[model samples]
Target: MGKSTASIDWLHRAPPVSGLERIEAYFSGFGYDPHRHDTYAIGHTLLGVQSFHYRGRKTHSLPGTTMVLHPDEVHDGWAGSDEGFKYRMIYVEPALIQQILGGKPLPFIHNGLSNDPWLYRACQVLVQRLDCGLDPLLEQDALFDLAHALNNAAGVNTSRKTFDYQAAERAREFIHGALTRTITLDEMAEHCGRDRWALSRDFRLLFGTSPYRYLTMRRLDLVRTLLGQGHSLVDAALTAGFTDQSHMTRQFRSTYGLPPSRWVRMLGRT
Candidate 1:
């Protein structure tokens, strides 16, 4: 199979927006291996067939359909046919989604694909182009629309259970401030003024991922930025709070579906 190394140049890169990274790429056959991330992989396949295994079944994403891969959901990607596939994706952290949902469970789009017009339109603001950078206010508005469309499309039960959004958000803020330090559940609980176990559950429910994973993701975010700024992998990993480069590499690959070096190369930074 011919890898689209030439197409890498067509990939437009933009700075992240409130933990949201946007990219547009074309894959000439197999794309990414099975991987999971602590953020929702929201995207639209612009061309060809985007196939992936999600929720125990192989799903094909076509044009005009929105793909919402829930946080931490294992999935892989490949073109469904020999012609390859082109897609635009926005990786949004659940904390950003929770900011709009206000402590509700993250919305789930069954089978990882949706043809709902509302969802398609809402996500279009972010996935429309790789070079389209969202302003602060516009980004907030887009996130709100996306969250609403997701809940509406999924028909999520809003009256299921009550959780403290304030508490979870507080812990999330603390994690952001202390990403360089070793954080613990007890410390987060004490800081957020809630029981350790309750706070942990609330964090997972409200944010769609565990507290540890959230912390790790934040650190990984830093690692990406550092590496983009020309820092060596070892230095970036160590500075980002990982034990070592290998440990950071493992986590990075697991979350991003590619090793750090490959990711950099694909960005044409090398």
Candidate 2:
């Protein structure tokens, strides 16, 4: 097979987020280079064989399969066969998944792919586009279901028993409220009534990323929102807690394969 490293063609049609963005696209060929994202690339492969190599393994994504590419992992993408591959993915900061998982433990899907039915169904809500915002109660329920489902998919049911889960939930809420605000592990721990180190470990187990990373995502989510609302890039970056527009621009380009100005221009044409 010929190697081709293209860029991710993104349709940023997601609800405005500060730290992360949800993207939908149908790619039929190689769609990435040896690039890494600051966020979690979570989504379903809709059709054909979406092939990518990461962590020293060649993985193929068939239809109905969910692929979880963890943060900062080097990976590349291409079609596994002549037919090409198509997928719809959401670019979520690990923080959101962390928020959903809380201090439990980050679910690990070995080989970066899964044919899990429960996970397939949970992803439906995410794939429904931003218009289909989950109702508060429904959102919470879905998230909880997703948490357990991920745990099972990642084979993290070692305890196999009930345990206090409220801390994770509380930590998640703190992350949300402090999106534009600065939050530290110690602060989150103090608020959630847990030791800082214990809280950090649980956070990794449940969310698959670190607390600091989680906070950065929250900030990025705000950046998206501000930009979508027509704020100037510099203004949005500052309002979103980035040091400056360049800081935001670097992350935006790295994650979405384009800068904020270019992204907005593309949106105008669309």
RMSD of each: 2.3, 4.8
Candidate 2 scores a C-alpha RMSD against the true structure in Å of: 4.8
TM-scores vs. true structure, each candidate: 0.92, 0.69
Q: Can you write out model 2's per-residue Cα lDDT over 1-270, one digit (the tens) per residue?
A: 464422333344765344344565544465555556655677877767888887998888887788878775667777787766767776654545655665454566767887889987876666665556646676556556765676678885566433335675678678878766666788889998998888776665555556766666567667766777899999999998888889888876665444677566545432
Clashing pairs in 1: none
* lDDT score of residue 207 within candidate 1: 81
- The lDDT of model 1 is 0.84
Per-candidate Cα lDDT values, in order, are 0.84, 0.67
Best candidate, TM-score-wise? 1
lDDT of 1 by residue, 184-260 (tens): 89999999999999898888888888999999999999998898889999999999999999999999989877788
Poorest 10 consecutive residues by lDDT, candidate 1: 1-10
